[model samples]
Target chain A: MTRPRVTFWRLFIVASLALGAYSIFVRFHEGIGGATNLSDGTPWGLWVGLDILTGVALAAGGFMITAVVYVFGLERYRPIVRPALLTAFLGYLFFVIGLLVELGRPWNIWHAIIYWNPNSALFEVAWCVMLYTIVLALEVSNLIFERFGWVRLSRVFHAVVLFLVIAGVMLSTLHQSSLGTLFVIAPGKMHALWYSPALPLIFYVSCMCAGLAMVMVEAFLSQRFLKHPVRVDLMARLARVLMIGLMLLTLLRFSDLWLRSALPLAFQPTEEALAFWVEVALFQVIPIVVLWPERRRASPRRLFVGAFSAVAGLVTHRMNVATTSFVSSSPTDYFPTWMEFSVSIALVVAGVVVFWGFAKWTPLFAEGEHPPHAAHRAEHVTRARPGPPTAISGCGRARRGARRLPAPRRWPGGRSTAPGTRC
Target chain B: MSKGMLIDITACTGCRACVNACRTKNRLDAPPGARLSETDFTVLEHRDRLAVRRMCYHCNDPACASACPVAAMVRTPEGPVAYDEHRCMGCRYCMVACPHGVPAFEWHSRMPRVRKCAFCPDHVAEGRPPPCATACPTEATLFGDRDALIKAATARIDARPERYYPGIWGRDVAGGTSVMFLSPVPFDRLGLRTDLGPDPLGHATGRILALVPGTAATVVTVLGGTYWLYRRRAAVAAEQALAAARDGADAAAREGREGGR
Candidate 1:
């Protein structure tokens, strides 16, 4: 049963990748005019809206998790930190790729590096994203170094891990907010419901929520598919943080709208108002209600549902902000072509396939294993132990069995007393 | 010294001479379209009795120039907003940023570039008016210094209040533009955006971007401080645990010696 299911997924990924390649060919061969429904009135469409905007926001988990574990010294979350970093690294890597694909002159993407336009929000976003991606790459490189048994290199990375985490946080904060600042220039073009001077602050807060939600979703997925143990305690705490973030975002959005006297716009009979309400319901109301109770937060299934809703809400919000809001002002309407959809799906499939590869081959989930780095020694004293060679073994039974195992012993230095015990 | 055009919509005869002259000057082969496009840098829109010439306004603080991340769109001192196609990465941000919906893209080309009126800076520099303005049969498209043109537009409106819209369209729209317009009716009636306020659109984003350095500094300081505090707490806890273990061991050793005696 498992073999067949795995084969089915493998075939799906391969097919999606093939279709994606063809889409790329069409996009480049036919140019944007022939391939997309976009026009002069709507220059940025699905690719900019989804692949770049939503993808980058969803990847905020890397900075959030790193800040939690390293900056706050939350030793229990250390196991998930590497996974989160890997996700962020891939998210940004694909964002750059998406940018290249969407750009009319992909070769000239480097012009942004040499040209100085401090006044342009995109210029600031481009610089921050570039620096942050590099920071994320360095953060995730520890897993690669560990996979190859490059103890010295891993140690070198660990020595400056704190510095990297701090830098990542700063960079992520700037770019995430600057993404919203991109829209601040065209106040007349965007619908009143999504436009505001406080957009940068609003984006920053919502991304925090989305980032935490993504971590929860990723955790649930890894546990179910990869046969990894789910740390319910840690996830519940994360859910609490997500709840606060969502509440804060909701407050910020509504207050900004109310202060601007645009709240009445939400009640108007227009498509923009409809989109705005839907965004609000999905992004705020549904997730907050689902994750409100402590019991629900503790239940992995319920938590996954909430996180999934939030993720979906985030995509909707970004799409609205990036594309839908311009509908009224744009002379022509735009709906993404099948080619655009295929390319976006292909990017996601590629991300998951790479993540699956890392999980299968690397010690991405070895709970107590410490890299041979002096920086880590102060936090954890556990000796390294190789995790299961195949992370995808007996799914439901393995999780149940893991739950029944006795809690691992801990020493005064917070090291596992029983070195060989699985978490 | 900034040059501009005073377009008198009331005087326009709905003739295509100015459009033809523009095509000739730019050496454009494609026939003129009804709307502004890659090939049609300028278009004549017929609204009832008015023939509005739609083109780039070339604002004092141009949003397209501010929005271009690569500095591909530049506002020259000579009053033309020039596009450096070689530098553009085809982000198409200028199209979205322009309040007038001006900057058209070459969506059909593999190596696309943003298309719009160049304002003919070279022509003006050479002491010649733009071809479209020079070709205007009724002198409806008058080219001169921006300040002088605004004054001329005001005088025309003031002299015959019923003949004009009683106000200059671009005197302060979007923080003032080089191309001022005089119309027989309200500007909005001719499908122009009158809602854009008197501030440069870039100011909205500029205000936010100015906070970036301070934001980065605060983030770094707060994160660094939090890490230090947490590490110190962890260190203190570890020391207490170590001292407790040492004391227990000593107590055990003393008890064992007493028991042996």
Candidate 2:
């Protein structure tokens, strides 16, 4: 009954939480002025730039995965549905937490529900995000019910799961585009390199890429750390979708620039221009290069790198849109204080911890009847851990050599039954 | 009728009386910078020899009102974009959406609210001129009917064509703001944004948002139909397989019975 030994990741998370707690104290005690470097000209800073915007974009995977599995009937992806939902739910929960820290009057946030401004795009986004969080909670409750052996509750959830999923998809679509719509009023404030009338379309398309890439990254991480059996074919299929999304996003973005006669701005020796190009390289060029190879594309590590690159690119893009785009118009130079950065980093660590905890406690990767590794699935352990592991020993075992545990029945590179096909 | 202000930069001395009057009238702190803040609603700035007073334009179709998620900032019929601190959620979208960068935040305070000029609606309600306007010695900041102000602004530019800039700022920019400016130099040179077109800033975003309902309905129908079709086909396949298995079992039993007979 001894707790697992603490690893570097666990130690890092703990340290971050402690440091961030102090900053949170300062923020509440002394107000935003003491904790952040934000001014009247630069009111939205790291919290809006990284924590809320990028966080929400990354969470897009939940709706996409649910749509693929439930609406399209892609049963192959059923294994990853719960994990995707968990990641999204945690992402959004932390997003709201970050917003609370950022908002001057967080207590009045519920006012958005009571007062409706039909003309305001932020109003739409606020409403959709609020509603979607509820929808996601309901969608994700099935796993919790099953884990607790609430058979009747689980049955009720199943009956309404499809309705919840449909509502989620609709809500996500509204807010995902609405985030971009928030910037439309700032045509003069935002640099020409990032501003366009087609911003909503660009945002929607890029969200698809972010969502697909995040799903791939999640699938790879669970396979790596949780020691879930590898499903290379599934990852490969998702990669293809990610690649297609990246291409469409690139095409749309470049076409927008070209049509607006803003293409010249991209070549300028300015910070905004350089950032734009970096976004293109990370989100568009690198992922395309990595996923182009049939063999390498199927490799779990390679796919993961590509997916991570795409996610990173999208994060940068969102940050650019939210904060960097306004730099030219800002009265003073803005850089986030250490306290702000720590708070953001802490939120991420908190999210990761919650995701890892949920994966361990619930049947996130309990592969179903048609699992590739049916033997392994048959031996699946539903035994609840006495308490949470202080750290993952799986990482250590992975480093020492994977010889400690039984090898997966099949590797992604080959069919296990065919000797010659094994890589 | 809606009111307005016409500020003639050429007539004003850099005495800053209007700035002081604004602070005293609004009960705000004496701020150091020429920019608007929670404590500073209006600031008197100098461009070479010309003295200019800066504050909210109070647009006919206010972008801040449009961008406010909770309608905390509302444009009144009397030509003021008023803010209700009690209704504010502190989202700061209004600050970002304002074309003139007029809205300021109470960043230093724990319970902050958006701070901006409301065109001195209290005085206008009493059928009196705004404090800034009344305090101006040269009538540099004129307050009256929006139409009369525009006509006067145009006449000044036309009568002394060599002394004034041709365009009357806020006459059409951002859908004709209630506060207009007449300057000797170009409006941009005087720190006013001339880039905003006549149409309201919210119009573009509004058009895009209008598509949401139709798009959502379409998606729901299409996706729902797809799910229904897929489920029905799966159910049909299952039923056929069950029937086939039963028929094979019945035939095998009959054959065994016939052989025994």
Against the native complex, each candidate's DockQ, computed on alpha carbons, is 0.62, 0.44
- Which 10-residue span in candidate 2 chain A carries the lowest summed lDDT? A413-422
Question: Candidate 1, overall lDDT?
Answer: 0.85
Q: Which of the CAPRI classes, incorrect, acceptable, medium or high, describes model 1?
A: medium
Clashing pairs in model 1, backbone N/Cα/C closer than 3 A: none
TM-score of each: 0.91, 0.90
> In candidate 1, what are the lDDT values of residues B127-235, reduced to their tens digit?
5799999899997999999988988988898999988888888988888898888999999999887988899999889988999999999999999999878767767
| Chain A TM-scores in order | 0.87, 0.86
- Report the error of model 2 at residue B111, Å: 0.9
Task: Give one digit per residue, the lDDT tens place, for model 2 in A1-423.
Answer: 123544766788899999888998888778788899888777788889889888888889999988887887776787778888988898899999998888888888999989889899999999999999999898887778766756446545755778888999999998998899988988888888888889888888898899889888887877766667767888898898898899899999999999999999888889889889889999999999999877787688889999999999998898788777788888876888999999999999898888888888876666342654453343222112332121234444232222312332221111121111111
Q: Per-residue alpha-carbon lDDT of model 2 for B1-261, expressed as tens digits?
A: 989999998788878888888888888865557778878888887776677788998999988899999999999999988999988988888988988888988776788888888788889876689998999999899999999988898888889999998889898898889889998889899888888888999898899999999989988998899988887776787679779999999999999999899
Residue pairs that clash (backbone atoms under 3 angstroms), model 2:
none
